[model samples]
Target: MTTAVAAPFRFFSLQVVRTRRLGPSLARVTFAGPDLHAFHSDGRDQSLSLFLPHPGQPEPAVPVELGWESPRSGEAGSGGGWWQAWRELPDDVRAVMRSYTLRALRTGEDGHTTEIDIDFVLHGVEPGSPVQAGPAARWAAGAAPGDRVVMLGPAVADNRAIRFRPPADTDLVVIWGDETAVPAACAAVESLPAGTRARVWLEVPHAEDVQDLHTAAEAEVTWLVKGAAAGPEATLATLRAAELPPTTHPYVWIAGESGRVKRLRRHFVGERGIDRRRVTFVGYWRQGLTEEQLREQG
Candidate 1:
């Protein structure tokens, strides 16, 4: 659903203002453009489809018409509208469409949007190479101040891309994820109302990868890193050893590897008796598979 591009969404041409390594495996790229003034989001894990250029291209490839809607033709953005039209273009022109969470956003007092930050995981396919160094990682690793790309993001304050929707009766909140889910968890945590009770567990690749976190909610954060005797098994060990609060009205959000997320979901729903509907679980990516492969499977 993050890749859904349609009305209430439009193309925004953005230029990179700067890029910095946030941690050993994370890079934060700040983007700015005139079109960003209309970009809006509700902040909780909001997603956008990025159009990154091929290795040597100056600008990202896009259709000349900039996708549009024709309700008279009965085409929705998914079935026969944007998705279909995008598919009809040449493979090289369509480029690579990847979904990403909005890490941060700033607006000026004059009411104009100033900047938006997106964090990219410096992962590659091989160990010591990053998590999985594909085109996005390649771009981020070498991004200059003026690099540009296109994205189909929110134009309204509240849209469907935000996947973190907790119920009104929710009391305790539990969120966990690997490095890829950090941006999502980061955005979602700050949205919690003040005094809300929440527990956050984040797993990254390095101890230096543990960055600062802020939240108005009563949050307890724990960082698990690779090679720190806190790998997957260690995560399960911690989960099994801990005592969680009562779960009659609990809300849980889990993301990362498909298998791990499923395991956590079962633990909460099967063991903890949390309502299945109260859990928002997403597998951002799967091990041994790329985003393109996942899309094809979907």
Candidate 2:
């Protein structure tokens, strides 16, 4: 059933329509649902919460809480209502929740979303990998057509979930993201208008993860291949030594590992002297912690 969790965002039951391997480390999954007629988004770095079922479950276990007077009221009950109830579920029985970005979407003539694409970063899924694959990565790697799932996504075209916003006077757009944030960064880049100037850096574990980005704007995109080292030192060194174009009004967007995001944000605001207000930074995930652990610490 479709449950309205909050205004501009709600739960929609969806099924996997198809899956495509984007690269060695990325997989693209497309989903569709009858209720997607209500799914609306402007699509620049749109954020979403995906709930996946465990291996053999027919669907993600999400109990809809309809006790509120208005689902759009933006208030939770004493125990936080559905969130609390869901949390109270047995660990193995509850749906696996993960935060992701909308990579792309298509609409019909009536302006209803017909399908949406999300790019999943596959980690440790390959044979004999050093790191263990996460739940979402494993689910995505073997995702097949007709796999059932659920999504908490935008119902408003211009919602607060979208973080990329360049002022009208912005002369330059600077962007950086690791593999996890590549989908969001790419969405922001693809949405750039004609004649806009942009510079982007995308870091990935392997060279095969490099993607060909298509944009109308005057954009210079660089793909940084990470070495065996497990930190952002190499990325930071590259940014420090590179030269940027002269622009008084520049907007910067950086996302990826939490620690690295902070470092890059500082480099832009402190080292490059860009206005902090003009820079948008997001930490998609932490290096050593699982998503559930990260949420718990929050």
Candidate 3:
């Protein structure tokens, strides 16, 4: 029922082949489908939109045709895009849409995708948790084999959705991400070439959420646990006190809560004197807002 307006992004009908719990706060779901023949991506921080059916529904209720212009209004291209059509769907009938990062994918001998993985952060899924579980978290917590879903992803290997880009002259790769961004950040770091220098800071809600990253790069990684030394103040303090290796050109990529991302960006550009053009900051979510509210504000 969720529709993306971009033609470059196409819909893929997928089903969960398996699921694995990564930690107390994270789970990995593997999906496969015939529609993956057209799915392609370079994979670094690749962004995707996923659609899920309501409880008891067999499949997501998407429109048969996502035409750019609706002719029913008796006007020429005045109706709006596919997003409008998706919004017009009844609340109970509409699919639950969530944004996720592509963790990894496997290809067949013919170079067609055979399967893909997405890691979900299970926020509020634990018993007696203070925060309430959102639909995506709740769905991911109980996702099982044969669960149907839909994804809006790239048809081209290289697209704008893949944002972890560093210039040719870059000598140091700096990364910071919270639990919500761990999947993308891990994928990006793991793909770095040998001899590359990197400094990574990954913050997770629990100690169990910390993961061992395998990378060819000479990377110094630090994991911060929430109640111990995570969050905006502690994270910033640690970064501020630490010393980075000498490098003429450094590229920085940070994603997480919007407010924290902004403060970290300022620390890199304003305090550390790194070039603003060399930094890429993404706000995956805001502290006090839902995805729908964030989209509406945009």
Candidate 4:
């Protein structure tokens, strides 16, 4: 009998089809598979779950004891299938699961996905370097054409992970982020309506990391390159000194280092007097802390 999977962690098999370097620090990997036709996306800031393999392991193995019930057993329809199931896994096993935004998603006239692009940061590896780094980054660095991985993403186009929500009457949109947030930011730009206007401040490790963004919205983007100024000190200085255009009906989106996100939140709500209701803030990552560590601390 075919099982109707109620679990959000339902797996969809995919394989790498190609890879491209978008900038000095970003590597774009394209994946394709038959199951992709059911891989729905909400189009803006849409992120998905990826399961990568440990070094020396060809594929991921989610043990039954870890609470990841297999669809084959028709047991995936049970209790909290994300974190609760995750908590049951060994720490190293849990570390292999990471979240990533869809840089691009394409569907064919036949209503099947011809391709999907995911841009990965080339982190923790250097010329003649050892492979001690995040599992996801290591996997992407070694991922070749035909390499496979599994995803737990949207089964329907409308899902909660697409967080770029602004009221219809919003006349101006403000966005900010660092390299890690670039995929989501660019996706937001792509989602704006034809006449939408936006001011975007994006920060990256280097100027070469900046790439062209495609959008119909009238946008002015300022690229912030990280230098000697530590923390959000440089970005905070720039944002404080800048003369912002008159905002009619404004909506703000901010995501980056947790510390920076906090500062940005204060700047908008405390200093700029923007209503707390008009903003979406996400802390993608933090310095010296892994995602799991943050969750545990929180």
Find the candidate with the highest TM-score and give its number. 2
Candidate 4 lDDT by residue in tens digits, 1-298:
8978544434677889999877666789999999887777777888777777676666665443444344345344234544456567676565377778888899999876668888887766546533346767778877899787777777767767778898888989999988888988988888887888899998886677889887899988888877435457778888888777788679999998988999998998999998889989988888888866875676
Candidate 1: residue pairs that collide: 123-130, 123-131, 123-132, 123-133, 124-130, 124-131, 124-132, 124-133
Global lDDT of each candidate: 0.82, 0.89, 0.88, 0.77
Give the number of colliding residue pairs in candidate 1: 8
| True-structure lDDT of candidate 3 | 0.88
lDDT of 4 at 275: 88
Ranking by lDDT: 2, 3, 1, 4
Give the higher-TM-score candidate: 2 or 3.
Answer: 2
> Candidate 3, residue 95: CA error in Å?
0.7
Candidates 1 and 3 compared by lDDT, better number: 3
Candidate 3 clashing pairs? Answer: none
Model 1 lDDT tens row, 15-125: 999998988789999999998988888888888788888877888876526354433454323455566667787877776778889998999897767899999988773
Please name the candidate that would achieve the greatest lDDT relative to the true structure: 2
Q: What is the lDDT of residue 245 in candidate 1?
A: 68
Worst 10 residues of 4 by lDDT: 70-79
TM-score of each: 0.89, 0.94, 0.93, 0.86
1-298: candidate 3 lDDT, tens digit per residue: 9986444567889999999999999999999999999899999899998888888888887653674334565321235455567778998998888899999999999999999999998988999988898988999998999999988888888888899998999999999999999999999999899999999999898888989899999999999887733468887898898899999999999998999999999999999999999999999999989988887787
Residue 225 displacement in candidate 4 (angstroms): 1.4
